[model samples]
Target: METNRQDFLKKFNEAFATSDVDFILTAVSDDILWTIAGDKVIQGKDQFASSLHEMASPEPMKLKIRHLITHGKEAAVEGTMTTPNGKTYSFCDIYTFNGFKDAQIKEMKSYVVEEH
Candidate 1:
């Protein structure tokens, strides 16, 4: 369980660093459910992938993980993302997972804890 959480966090952190929809989708389940702080919900892998592709940017971005905690099939993560324009946002993310032999993200909820 511990190793799984660490691996998942690594993948998730990787997802935020690039605008590659395919690489980002690799960490999620086919029926992924994602909700943003703005109350927008993206359902299913196809829809999620499409949304990401549409929002892709050529600018650089960086993600720094502050902390990650997991228990059973759930986890909470804290991090900061620095955008190309030099804006920064600190976020808290909650994730739910359920899989046959290993945990895969089935749902994710994101909240902006701070911004600058």
Candidate 2:
């Protein structure tokens, strides 16, 4: 069960690099809340989808997952994303799921930093 959840989270993060909005939306609940630290707070699946569209880039990002940790209905993934232009950003996202079995993300808090 833990392994499956970990795999799901890995795919979920990879979807961001590929800009797979449909998969992203499908992984979350209707009332999903996302807080991007120092940026903006997104509420609901609709708003989340809108934000993703607004931030879509022509070039796909290269993502490296450094660590993935999960406990109960919570999880955290830390990684670095490198843009096509050579810009790299380190990020950590903490997630809360709706439940333990067949969980869907209920809330997410992300912290991102650009490496100088």
Candidate 3:
């Protein structure tokens, strides 16, 4: 079960760079709340989907995950994403799952900083 959750989180984080909206949505709950630190907060699947589309780029970003930690119903992922234009951003996302088994992300808080 631990390994399963870890694999799930890996794919979920990678979905962001791949623009795989459907996969992301499926991994989250219907009433999911996403807070992008210093940016904006998104609630519900509809808003989440809209935000995903708005942030989607023509060329997929490259993601390099540094760490992934999970315990109980909480998880955190740290990574750097490099855009097609050569810009890189370091990000750490904290997540809360709906349950321990067959979990779906119910809340997420993201802290992202652009690399100079």
Q: Give each model's whole-structure lDDT.
A: 0.80, 0.94, 0.95
Candidate 2, position 88, lDDT:
94
Q: Compared with the true structure, what per-residue lDDT tens digits does model 3 show for residues 1-116?
A: 44888999999988999889889999999999999999999999999999999998788899999999999999999999999999999999999999999989999999999999
Native-referenced Cα lDDT, model 1: 0.80
**CA shift at 90, candidate 3, in angstroms?**
0.2
Q: Give per-residue CA lDDT, model 2, range 1-116, as digits (tens).
A: 44988999999998898888888999999999999999999999999999989877678899999999999999999999998889999999999999999989999999999999
**Candidate 1 on 32-63: residue-level lDDT in tens?**
99999786899999999987887676875788
What's the C-alpha lDDT at position 59 in model 3?
85
Query: How far is each candidate from the true structure, as Cα RMSD in Å?
Result: 2.2, 1.4, 1.3
| TM-score of model number 2 | 0.95
Error of 3 at 89 (Å): 0.3
Give the clashing residue pairs of candidate 2, or none.
none
TM-score of 3: 0.96
The lowest-lDDT stretch of 10 consecutive residues in candidate 1 is 1-10
Worst 10 residues of 3 by lDDT: 1-10
TM-score of each: 0.85, 0.95, 0.96
Better of 1 and 3 by TM-score: 3
